[model samples]
Target: MFAASIKSKTQSLRLQSSRLMPLSQQYRAQSNLSNNKSYWSHIPSWKGVSNDEFVSYRWQLRNTVSDKLKLYKFLDEVLPERLGSTENEQLKRIRTRTNFIEDAIAAIKLAPMAIRLTPHVLSLIDWNNPLDDPIRRQFLPLRSSIIPDHKYLELDSLHEEQDSPVPGLVHRYPGRALFLATSICPVYCRFCTRSYAVGGNTDTVSKKPQKPSRKRWEVVFEHIANDKSLQDIVVSGGDSYFLQPDHVREIGERLLDIPHIKRVRFASKGLAVAPGRILDDSDPWTDNLIAVSNKGREMGKQVCLHTHINHANEITWITRLAANKLFKHGVIVRNQSVLLKGVNNTFTALSDLIKSLSDINIQPYYVYQCDMVQGIEDLRTPLHEIIDLDKQIRGTLSGFMMPSFVIDLPGGGGKRLVSTYEKYEHGIATYKAPGLPGAKGEMTYTYHDPKPVKTAVLEEFQQRQLEALERGETLEQFFAQSAAHLPRSPLPNPSSNQNPLRPQTTSTDIVPEFWAPTPKPAYAYSQGM
Candidate 1:
């Protein structure tokens, strides 16, 4: 009887694989477009560029877009006269080249993050349908889709500034610390949680940029050495990728030398956005990283690279080769992805991304809820969406491959599982961080979903706001005249430490129901949950 049962199950497994084999092959083929194609040549300026030139890390840096004029020129060259239409009602107004450019420039003026894009990332955007493309949505701000910030959205949402013991070192958790080594990235994300300090100053924000300097770093290093309880250190900045090869080695070695430090993670999104650097033999960035990993292993401490790659589309042949190089070299690499509204918020997108990552041997570490930061209300999904998506994706992957879906609680309460909420109702979800030290452990933190606006009303509001922006009205002036009648949002928990960072509302409808019904399970290959 046992043999018969086993035989039947084995036959069933064969049947399932046979059916999925073709689709899986198709998926791999579509994903490896860079296998033969020079993907960046699609852009006008790089039409005649060779693969060697394109793969040079220096070439990517020299061609990176930083200022408004370069960005505008790129947009003019890439966006078609008439863009492909979209299912997104909020982004419908951005169909024409003129509509898209004007709306984007205006959005840039209001954004907290400045524009910065590498040629590799630029090449990945589907210009034919820029507005709805996930890569474009993550890096570029669109005024048409911009909405009023939830009353709780803040510039420094996690209260990093409050917990920062040293100027750039954030000591929040008992044994862990975030060493912000710089304030620049190869590409500035529109939804950056560290907008308070990263990137150049935008029109709406004056930044406290943390430039790389050994003088400044010594204080941070000394503090870490003295703190006997510290065991983990996350060295992040504009990005460790922006650091010189020497900086990477120095920082990694310095931290590893500390007696209490058991782990050192150098965080950067370079492997995803500018992957060629890992393959550039002339560059020593990858060499330094590998050296540190080997040294840490010999010392019985762990040193690894924590990269951010949110979408599977961000992974190319270069990304795969880069990941493989690290894996073969004994460099441990892990990924942390953000759950953006139009990006990887669905179970299918999220699960596919996880599978794609694990296939390259990069552990899918954490799927973070979007932070409560300024200028990115458009990218945030309601809290329940993350909770539901987590349920749908958990059992689909191997136990070790599954990621922790969490929200880094809005004050300094730290990361907790999405389902660990103390109370969730009326578009508001509250949690307590008992893991945090002091009274903060007993205090409650809160997260409010972006307020709703009916589609027609929101589209109208965008049109009016865009008109005001063109006529020289600042983002502040436009909101000042329109907020009086909108509904009030829930205040933060009194015991929590977040100060409300609400912008005056242009308009909003209440999100009355916070609890959603348990969703039906998704098919393995479905496009959405």
Candidate 2:
């Protein structure tokens, strides 16, 4: 009887870790969807899947919408016949499901990062409003929306390859090295800065991947062991989440064993894109992560997870539970978001994301300016967007809750403050990173805004993208050929639009028509909206 009481107490404690007593219940009652709703059921094919099967990591992997064939099949089933439109002129014309599928297919052919989507991310997309859905914009690109690449963009925008002394290891900073553990991710995003190496080869970019293998990692591990100046290591690549549970344990334990290593961060988007994996009792990934964090604490060192979460919609009740479970077991998690043009560039969108993450105990770490990477010009906002957003978001939250608005500089210059530019004229801004050592610190890195487009020629460029695909031309060749034809009227200067003394007009402020979509009156059918 005494043993039974102990077991009962333990179960209650577990519930406290895995469930938000008041908030979860309230959310469930409102959505009738978050806690017990098999939201995945909305997908025609997954209609019969139960909550248990949907939560399993194995099941998620087996059902991942990978490659062109699987994606086309899934989109056909999930997307409504009539799609909603967005104010973004580039995508406003895609009003039907068939049009969207065609654009997606063409975009996949030219995109640098390959198309890969998890069930969770797929489920989050408002398929009814497929064109403007922020989640769709991130993972699946639309060829019709493609714009000419920024002149400064490169396939390997960060110069990770040049910075590597050994394969799969980037030693850009003096005291730290980024260990490329695996060139694989649960889901691939359109704006990945590591476009040259992160995903399976797309037509536009052939990946030189760092496959996840113990033998492959031995060289990276050895280099860290030998380097006395290295105090920090970030295990990232496609993502650390792709690393096996045993692999996570071994890598974390090994890094902790390094004599001079003071901090270790495993970078993964798993928490955002595949939160169910963390909550799955049958899976050991989170268990291994917790073990690593605990071991690091025992050794008087720090081990934490650095996740990428761009928008608030990405955070569901499942994500909250997963994050809570990690926190309950003492895992330190932080989020870094890219300030995309339409996604979280607005004050309301960005603020909502920050608060949602903080509520789940994930510290909002860095809000990055979208990197000037190849083939996703539509996503990259001008440098002023971040500068403006950084100004608007300050003091709205506690100092700790606020994130640093930063730009990871183009061509190997590391992350720097967005507002710290040496010069700003037209669309180009220049910055110097003196904190970096040697010649790097002395260099002035320049960042360019996405090329401003004339409304008259938007359709012309769209035609060029599809024509280039038909001719079997690479995206690089297409951009090079199309650059001179693109309109280049100067965008308004950032200073002219703002007054620090009063309330300001930020880019994110939208009219009723452009504001986020509301649920349909009768839920729009299909087990309903």
Candidate 3:
């Protein structure tokens, strides 16, 4: 009877697997539109350009729309007058308000991750409706970035620097290492996690580290070579692809030489932002990548390309072409996306994105909660919302299509499954997980809103004031009565360490309290009073 039960379970598992196989195959078939000329014809910029020039990676790089002025000129030609005028006004305002310090900071941040959008990606923007365009939102700077409320946000949100033993290499996970190969990309994302470092900015918000030199790289390679435990290495930075093709090949070869290194993964947004770089067979970069993949195959090691793409609209004909090229070279392609609030946060948007990736043979890997980087509060969604969205979409997506919704805990705690909220209270959720750095046995983390939390007392004060007015009390009388009942205390000296609102603990594990307002008297309210 036990044998029969085991047989039944195995059969059930096989049946489920078979059911999922066909859906993936079907999507792959639907995604192949190489013969579809109509789709390419609709892009206005693609008109008058021969297929050879359109597919040339060099041409794409040479014609990138880099500066604000260049982007404006392109928009002026393609967008409606009204939309163009609005964008121009916003840009003009930003330019007018720029000061020396602000300009210095912007220059610093943009240095490592310079803005350079290829024509193919530029054409993907819906110029008539740029406000809601996910692609546009990802690359373009916004006015909300200048808001002062974001001062409390951390410059190094993930504390990646704290985990790094070397200048370029971050050995965070036990078996995996992160190699920051370059500090450049085709286009700079406004919410880039490494905005403090990657761009060639000399004046960074965080403690700026020196650029990785050949000598520094030698030290990094030596460190990896000496470590036997590390089996996987993630080659990334501004974008790994931004490194010269020969340099990329050399890095891959060096990693493969390390006996314990079983897998080497390259992370880049270039596949989506500048597909022609790898899609064009004539491009030297494409050839070099192919050679590297071939070498990895020879060594019996896994070589993969993990591309960053947030929206389904980003998966275009060129993206598919690039993915297919990598596929042919025996490089497994996957996607890792950030769950930006207005970007791909909804179930429908995420569903479409993963499905589109699956259609092109790109496995959906991780959907990370946006980090608490300074000036990026607008992009982050509440943890509960991210968890709910994951739950809503889990049952509907194919197992391969469902990416893990993860949050890298602040202060080098490593990645945690966002769904693992052990307890929720007062807009704060507690997550307990083992093996977290600096945690003692089942470490508990508290996640709260970045915005100021309104205390119950404050709410009650407002409510009582409203009720007093309904009873026909004058504003002065209400204030006078309230003041009479309130408790008095000696004002704190500016130099004292008597802050009641700040966390009093000495433990480094504590998350700082977001509220820092002056203390108020405790209030007691009775139902009939």
Candidate 4:
């Protein structure tokens, strides 16, 4: 009887120990969806709104903060401090019709890509401190972006245009083909690799048409269908989620019809920028997504949704809800993030982001080094920093949660593992891309330091130009004379409105619209009213 009592005590002790352990280690870990968190509870605008209304994707889209005035009004209400003394001065300048700051802001808007912010994304911002807000940094415009620095960077950083056998499809890899379905995004990221193509940039060097027509799509489909070697197809654009539900469904159906096509993945930022596009039960797009996913499942093919989420802060409760809904519908979700300086560059930031994604059942895929895209020199971090950060975070997280640090080699050379750096020197690192053409030699890349640009340096440069002009030299003559000695690309002519980089084209055929069925009024979809 004493032995029996001891055995009972031992069992009780074991049970207690098990209970003391963290819930994650206690059993097979499930998704963090079981934990309830209300991300939108703090929003004043959402107050007194029904859950149905709040969750409605259409409501989110319809109420998107598109205009500068709307954005200013929202920020004023929430965080009056954002438009502090400096912004107030700028506003005063605008009210007085002064052209200083007003012209600067106007130039930024007119330069290629325009500003676009969804209400759902805006709600994620900490209005009190927007400048430091990761979400705002990714979407909001800056005057520095208009400045012509980082002349070394190419307009087509990845050389995507060269790799494209067709206008809309990019076949960079052997078996995979990327289909540019639409050239529109819910929110335009400031550091977009394809900024030249998307957002209606008429000033791009590559004169390739923005969106594909019905005939162009047919040709693309034929190319994929004919190539049996191609098994995986990535449907992306400004964002594939921007496409209508029927269009997405049709694309999937067409891909499935190709017997060799084993996987169809949709690359979109909507899951992060605009989750309502997928989560709203009332929206027919969600139903169409489910139907396409189900069809892929029945055919024994992989249908996945790959999202671009850079920062940990981007993963909100609403994002999780949208992901969870997709999960329930048997769609596999994954995340790919760009490793931008001051963004997700730190070990702590990346760790939190990867952990957050894993918790939501979305696998962290790739942490790509910021591409050598023009106008994004401020965002790019050095290769050494990225490598060190990757090492620091690798062992701390699960294998699936850890992302591969990769760099897409310039001139269509393709993505290379950043770990295999052939050489490192003074601000220059050489990497040997896997399947690049010609000699298998390491390619040298230069990355600038993260220090802020000195105002004096810019002033000095401008002062020299003014001095030359005062000496009776024409601005064009001055620039032309400077170009002979300088190792930089020639600056665009200020006298001509036409972009010198843009190829002259005479084609006048109307391309088929990919967003909505019927043509809507310009005000309905204009970036900033």
Candidate 5:
């Protein structure tokens, strides 16, 4: 019976592949286009172009010519100037791969693939053109934060088991534990903070750690049961939803048995990276989500599916259908996005993304600044750009749709809010600022005013605020600090024991509080002060 089912699924997948453009054919099309020299004159210079400007240019030109043809022309114009002197053949290879993907996407028939192609289009962007500077292009944070990857299990480090659970099971938080379940993903992101574990193609994980055997799942449960302080288990892997339905149901049952484990959350990118996995009702993973939700409810635990979607364009019909199914099964839905340099870095892009997510009943969660994995240096956007983009997004978006922008400190300290730094310039740090762009610059708003201006006071004040944040201040503390609201001078430096950028336990984790559901608002709450 099992063999029959497996064979049935394989056949179904093969059928689906037939309707799709074969990756090989797509590659050949792009290669043929690139070899044609006729389109070279239309190619534009890569110089003096900001990522946003480049995107605008692509959209403006998209109708005039095919994306593949445009890319062929683009490469022709820039290759001579950029690749002529560089020995890093890797960059050239990536460009070629990108060209193929772009051409394929331009002709894709599936709605989900169309949405998926949007990020690929954005990825080809160049945000660091020196000529683009001073133009102040918006960007997502793709750098290492206070929380570092070193704190977690490195990819190549494990061998005894297929998967293993870390001892610090319950991180700094009382009710949350990070569950490393799988080491697989359909697409490898360049700026993944957990790059050491995800995207096996990169050599970064070649010498890291491996997961222990399934027996280790019990070890994870034992840790959760022993730690009365913890009540929720965040089931994460390269992507938790990647697990089979039976595995998910079994994990759910185990968590449900633990009276203390009140929630089971699946952190999965499958909904975004490989929505097809979830689109087919016959897919076991799709069944797993329903089964897990049922088990959680039966055990009285809140079951939620947290999806990672970085752009508005990623909301495809397949993902939308999958999200709806999860919700119908009594599973709450939420989304987390990582801010990256060339992808969804602008206010317009973020605003569009949030609106789309909200429309599908997925509450916007954290918009994490990118982590500090090696090779992701290309994805880091300036901190100031994130702040500026947040400012633009705050008013237009509903409060629920606005995610807390954060930087996960390196060395496993945990996530620290990045958007709170806006308070440094004003004389005082307050939750609601007085000088937002449209609110008459006097009315109160969610953001705070920077420390008051004083040539003498400015630098010192910024230093203090920066120091405090590095110390792992919560979103509330970072923005709420004022001369009157703070403790005595020489205020406790949260990061005093280590570099602020590296991870340290933040105030939120130490408190003996259970993970509580955010209270639903009575009405459409505006970001009114």
Candidate 6:
């Protein structure tokens, strides 16, 4: 009984560490069909909605099968004639959108036992032909909004010039490297930035596109072996986790052998699109993942997982359960979101995403400006809006939850921050530090203030702080004394009387007087917004 209780408590702690409550007991809460069947039925299944309604619903159900297909069709039909005549001659007016049944079967046949399929999977398909608005109301999809084309253009240009250390590898950052581990994804998105790497398109500019073979991975390992500066490697492809568990573990074990490579992370959206792949007990692949993650932990290397989840709704019960499995087995999870137009562009949407990620114990790390990729011009929200959204999100959520808004600089220059309202420059910004209002020596203060008056405020507060200390007052008592009176001496000692630790000086010293704060160039300010 005691051992069982201990096991229960340990499991509970493990769930808590993953930043979500125990979900094994909450499976019933995640019925996808319970309230969604009716909603999904009304959205005009792949048959296509009217042009007006079709475009309107593009952002609304960006992730859904019907919605993505419609958008792809719209682009195929409209973009070439409307915006760029270049794309017109290349393809048909409405290119066929591949459904899961056909695509999954094709993928399975290519690599037998690569992935599992259940009979219930077919039931999950929406075969109903009728459009039902009442049922659609239950899903409450994202609102529609316009985004610019430059976002993808910028991402393309940046990545184009970046040096490829090996085939399918991007080594832009100093300490970290990105490996395009594969070209296959369980589900393909039209806006995928790694266009060349995914969907079996091997025309990546730098490297020759050949069929993925073990020999190629060996080269990747060799590159890592020589690069002493590269301490972290991010395994990303169309989706690294989409590879068979043996393939995944093989990469993990190979990465583990590199003593200098302290961290190996898999960047994927698989957990969102196909959580079953990670959790099904009948699948040997699941055990392989667990083994890989455990081996990573045992080797004293950080086994991290960076998943892409754009909205809160995507964190279904199955995803939560799967995340717990990864965490309990010792893989840390983090989320990197693209700030796409119409989808999570608002503060509320961003906040909810952050909160949900935090609730599941996954750190919300990067709120990236959408990548500039072809056919995704409509998805880029303005950078300024992302800045404002970041401002609103800063105080509302925990530091871990609030992700940094950044735009990968054009021409592969590097990532630059999309400035928030805080206007932080040169790593100099102020927040209300410790101490309460009206506390003796405590006063309204500006942190990192450049002016003398602001400097005097800190000085006076420190003086009073010392005097209060000599009186044998505890730090709490000192703050209370400064805070005791009703806002009197709104400006405490302008000199240094507040703190007795140092001599009071009225005139500001020129030589050592004011710390010359680093001046932020105008271009830095202009770039973020």
Best candidate, lDDT: 1
Which candidate leads in TM-score?
A: 2
Candidate 3, residues 1-529, lDDT tens digits: the string is 9999999999999778655543223233334434534333445666677655666778888878776566555554565544322342223323322321233234323222345677767777776665556786677645323221122344455566666787778887778889987767777776787765655432123224334367878988999999998999998876877778778888889999899999999888888887766655455666666667778889899888899999998887767766876675577888989998668989899999989999888999999877765444456678877889889999897787889999877555678898776776555566665764344325665555444323343334445544665676632344456445544343556688776333332222222232222221121000000
Clashes of each: 2, 1, 7, 0, 45, 28
Give the range where candidate 1 is weakest over 10 consecutive residues by summed lDDT.
520-529
Off by over 4 Å in 2: 1-35, 480-529
Question: Which residue pairs clash within candidate 1?
Answer: 182-238, 184-238
Query: Could you tell me which 10 consecutive residues in candidate 4 have the lowest summed lDDT?
Result: 508-517
For residues 1-529, write the lDDT of model 6, one tens digit per residue. Answer: 9999999999999767654423322322343323322222233343343322322212223433333343344323312222211131211122223331222222222110112211112113322310111111111111111111221132133443235756667777677887777766555553456543345321111222334578888888899988988889988876775667788888888887888989989888777656655544334555655567788778888777888877776666556667776666567889988876555777777788888888877888898876555323345555566778878778877565678887654445445566522333321221221221123113221111112223334344445544554565633343334344413222246584564212223333311112111222232212210
Could you tell me every candidate's TM-score relative to the true structure? 0.84, 0.85, 0.71, 0.74, 0.52, 0.55
The reply for model 5, stretches above 4 Å from the true place, is 1-170, 201-205, 421-529
lDDT of each: 0.81, 0.79, 0.64, 0.64, 0.47, 0.50
**What tens digits encode model 4's per-residue C-alpha lDDT throughout 1-529?**
9999999999999889876744223321233333545455566776555555656667777777666667555554565422322232212322221223343344344334555777777777775544446676677644332333342454565667657787688887779989998888888787888765676532212223356357878989999999998999999887887788778888988998899999999999988887755655445666666667888999999889899999888877777777877776678998989988667888888888999998888899988888765445556787788889988997898776788888777656677778776766545556666564444334454333222334444334345444654576633344445445433333457687966433222221111110001221222122211
User: How are the candidates ranked when ordered by TM-score, highest leading?
Assistant: 2, 1, 4, 3, 6, 5
**Considering only N, C-alpha and C atoms within 3 Å, which residue pairs clash in candidate 3?**
108-201, 111-199, 111-200, 112-198, 112-199, 112-200, 113-199
- Candidate 2, 493: how far from true, in Å? 24
Model 2's alpha-carbon lDDT is 0.79
Instruction: Superpose all Cα atoms of candidate 4 onto the true structure and report the RMSD in Å to 1 decimal.
Output: 12.8
Candidate 5 global TM-score: 0.52
